[model samples]
Target: MKDTEKISLLSRLVAMNTVNRNEIEPAKYLKQLFDDAGIKCEVLPVGEDRANLIAEIDSGSPILAISGHFDVVAADAKEWATDPFTLTEKDGQLFGRGANDMKSGLAALTIAMLELKAQQVPINGTIRLMVTFGEEVGELGAKMLYDAGYMQGVNALMIAEPSGYRICYGQAGTIDIDLESIGKNAHSSMPALGSNAVDHLIRVLYTIKAKVMARAAGLHNAVLNTDTLFNIDVFNGGEQVNTIPNHALAKINLRTIPEVSNAEILQIFHDVIDADAAKYGSQINMHVEMDLNPVVGDPQSKMLQLIQRVAKPYLLNAKFSASDQQQNQIVTKMLGRELPAGTIPALGAPGGTDARRLLVDQPLGFDYTVFGPGNFTSHQPNEYVSKSMYLDFIKMYEELFPAYFNEA
Candidate 1:
């Protein structure tokens, strides 16, 4: 595919407001692209205005799958310098809501698929693209796809999350919990008349910070080289100032490592709540809102080597041909650092991706990596992607698909 075609497709994708849902329209648009290419594609609706698209080059063993999500996090246009939905190219960067987070990666993958089909590249195995929605909120779309047996496959998978050309062999898992403390309401004039739920919750939070979190900090994974991250993201209590608050709520998010399992993490919260209740007669309820296990790929796996090898020249050169200079300048700027002369990409990702859902059942069975363009700017105001990096990744995927399937 030409660079013009790539930019046009990405612009069209970003123009659609798929903030939370309403993925059906984009799915249809992509389906039309595949149909025009005479490729086999299907749009599977998961909910009203929400859907998943699956396109294939062939059907057989040794299947290689690429996964990406089109739905992006909500963006307030007022906060951005450019219209968040319109793909604006300025200063060699593409500014848009989903541009950095994923639409660029998704578009690049689509372009690779289309290029391969158009070229009539010979493939002994299947190359599939699983387009999903609702990845930012949770891996809801991926879960639905996995539960429906979309992952019952023969081989490797790559999640095109924003990683700035790095190869992420492992990513931290996450669990979101909602904890509510319930107590009796009474007048503030009588200090001891009401058992203040807010007070009880404060104690619980303190205990967790002092005991549980400190212990989690010590538990680290050698591969990921990171310890578990614990955060009390949201807290709410007290409707009025005069009355003692009868109820309080806290939303907790934990980025777990392989060293700690989800079951064990949940038990820690349970133990904390139980111990606090036993001592202070506090009524605290815990509800698990979301749970996804960590994904760790073999560092020495063929898939990792393949990606590392393919990405080496790009990391070293940091620039494409003279004809592609305009699209190549953003690579260094986006990463905020120069790639050490011969350094290969590293193995850890701070954020989670659809790999969490894909590998939940057989966490260690598949070869998976989070490899793509873009960076930490994702989900922030003025979210943008390096136009050069976006163009480079498209060529990389085009090369990788043929090499992985031995069609070259």
Candidate 2:
């Protein structure tokens, strides 16, 4: 297909609502695309309707994996000027939900494969195109792939997450925590008769904030943002306004640096809760919602060098800087907050991704880097990618394939 045709194909993909929870149709569409291109594809089921697409160009020799997520975050129609699920082109930008976060990247990879087939590039290794679902939730699909040994024989991997054309080498870890406090109930008329669980919970939250702040203060590469540490997302207690609440719960999420383990942080929270419970006559319960370790790729890998060489000409006279800066800013804005000090140097993660899972859980020997088109418009209404940018990405991949996979 011509570059324009490729853009149209991408627009059709963006129009499809593959939002994390609902991705079956998109998976089927992708399988059809691969089949038409004469690529062997497999649909790995994750849940009832959620599937992962793995298409292989060849089965023998060392394998090179190119991956992206099919799922996108939910979007609100009123917030966008155009339909969130329908691609709209305006001022050189293609707008729609999942336009930039990933569908565009996936299109680039798919087009590159088509171009290779048309030219019959003599590749010494197999090239696998992996489209996974549930990246927005937790790296569920990636975890399943790893556990199922779907990623076993790759020599190298590239995650086409939007990096604004720069290679991403590292990302911070994440931890989600929940803390609750319980007290005896009493009638509102008897003010002092019953303990105030809400008040106790606040005190504990404040303590955690302080500790996180203290940790943030001493770090150079790490950050600790306490403001987001305790998000009172859901709360339950008190039968009525007249009754003193017997219980209260607060859900806190912490994004940690590589230096801290989730277990260590959980212990700290437990200690604080225990102390508060002992002094305030309340019961404390804590649970961990999610925990992910930090991930970093080799700075001087062949893949990194190849990417730099391929991107140099496209960058032209444009000032080049680490792509992570914009990525971090975009993520922070999406979350409506700033990262905390000591958290992890914004090596470029205002949010986490499957990259961490690939780096930490996958076995060694393969180099991994994240490179893709578009800026940080991921997860927002009217998210988009420019046609020129998408085309450039395909060309970049074409140049890279030979450098990394062709033997001497």
Candidate 3:
């Protein structure tokens, strides 16, 4: 596919309102593209208005997979200078909601698959494009796919998560928790008559902050060289100020390291909530919203080494800067610290990706890498990816698939 066709596909994808779990339409659109090219594809419905698109070029053993998500975080148009749903290009940057986070990577994957099919490239293994939905929220689609035996024969996998061309071999795990307190409602004027759910929940929160948060900071992971970071990001208590809150809810998000298991964290929450409930005489309940394990691959793995080799020329000869000034400054500093352009180092991703879902059962099951276009504009207003990098990624993917097959 030409650069224009790639951009056009990306534009149409961006124009679709896929925020907050609406991905069925986009899945269908991609299916049509594959169908038109006479490639075998299927749209697996995940939920209402949500689906996963799987297209494959079947051959033999050692399946090589390219996985990416189509869902994007919520974008408020008022906060963006341009329409968040419309792909806007200015100063060599394509701006949109999913432009940086992942749609650009998805577009590149799509184009590469089409190109490979059109050229009738011979391969010893299968090439599968596993596009998922609801990755932004909880990786629900990825979980569904994994549970349904989609990854049974995958020998090598590349997740097209936005890495600014950096080779990511590992990522931190995440646990989202929700805690609620239940009590009797009463007027604020009569505090003695009714139990305040907000008060009860606050006590629990204080205990968690002092006990869990304090200890998490000291728990370190030797492999990733990081500590668990915990935060209580949401709280809901009462509907009106004049009445005592009969119900209270608190949401906690924790970026975990390998040092502590998710089960250990849950145990701590259960102990704390049980104690608080007993002490306050209020019904306190806890639920695990999502739990994903961390994965760290061998930095010197054959897959990564091959990727580094294939990507060297592009990285060294690349000519593009971030459209956002702040983003450019950060990238410049990072590159300065690790000089010699075109050098792709294997590093741990700060944020989690679909790799967590894919590798949950076996952390080191396969050679995995998260490499893609776009800088540090993910989930922010005015998200953008340089046109040069986006196009280069398409070329990279085209070369990468066949290169892996030849070398594997």
Candidate 4:
């Protein structure tokens, strides 16, 4: 397809309000596109009004998986210069909510499938295309697929996340904790008679932060930043001004490096809470909100060599960087108490994506890497992708499939 046509396709995808909450419309549209291209497609419903699209060029062994998320982050209409859902061109950039963050990547893959179908590219193995939902909200769709065993027997998996044409080979794990403190309620006038749950909770949070910072101070290659150590996103306490709160809840987010296990960190947090509870005579409740393990693809594997070969002819250089290494390193440094003495793994750090759930928990056991066009604009206002970048990505996919499928 021509560059303009490719941009137009991306524009249509952006026009559809496939924001994280409403992905059905785009899922339907994409299914139709695959149908028109004569590719076999299926819609896997993830939950109420949410679905995932799985299509295949052909079905058989040595399957190569191409994946992208159909959902985009929510956008505020007032924050955007143009309608956030409508694609507009300005200064050579296609501006829209989903344009750059990923709808463009989905379009690029769709167009490649169409071109490959028209050319009747001889395929020795199957190529699977999956457009998933809820990647922005903890990779829900990917987890669902992994649970259902949809990724069985995949030789290689490629996720088209916006990475500026680079390859992502490693990422950090994420763990969220919710802690609540309970104490006896009493009138504010008699402050000494009542236990202040909020006060005790703050002390515990501070302790956790200090522990993380101490760990970070000892690392050389793996430095921790205070920002990623612990985040108290939500705090709730007494409803009335005159009364001391009997209960307080705080939510903490911890992004962990591959060096640490979620279980280990959870134990540390529990110990901190237990000590605080003992001093205050307050009940402590702790729950894990989410746990996403880190992922790393082999950089020297045949997959990396194949991707480089496919991208080189188009003058696109692909480098492997883990998606969220910086965030993970900083968080781990702050949370870990001991100086972790070891050569930091050669793999790149983790960034947030559905690849985590798909490859980490799933039995597919395929070597997974993320490569795509577009710059990083996820969850931001006025995101966009270039017309040239979109089309070039299509060409790359077209070249990649045959080689990947024909390999013995």
Give TM per candidate.
0.90, 0.84, 0.90, 0.85
Q: Rate the local accuracy (lDDT) of all candidates.
A: 0.83, 0.73, 0.84, 0.73
Expressed as tens digits, the lDDT of each residue in 199-313 for candidate 2 is 7877888897777656555443322222223244665656788888878888776766544555666677888888877787668788787777656556566777678777877
lDDT at residue 147 of model 4 (Cα atoms): 80
Please provide, for model 1 over 200-251, each residue's C-alpha lDDT reduced to its tens digit, 9 standing for 90 to 100.
Answer: 9988977875665666767887556568888899999998999999999999
Candidate 3 per-residue C-alpha lDDT over 10-107 given as tens digits, one digit per residue, 9 for 90 to 100: 99999988886779999999999999998899999866899998999888877888999989988988899999989999988899999988999999
Which portions of model 2 show Cα errors greater than 4 Å? 59-61, 188-193, 222-242, 275-281, 317-347, 362-366
Ranking by lDDT: 3, 1, 4, 2
Better of 2 and 3 by lDDT: 3
Candidate closer to the true structure by TM-score (higher is better), 3 or 4: 3
Clashes of each: 1, 11, 1, 13
In terms of lDDT, model 2 sits at: 0.73
Runs in model 4 deviating more than 4 A are 212-228, 239-242, 316-350, 362-366
Q: How close to the true structure is residue 325 of candidate 4, measured as C-alpha lDDT? A: 38
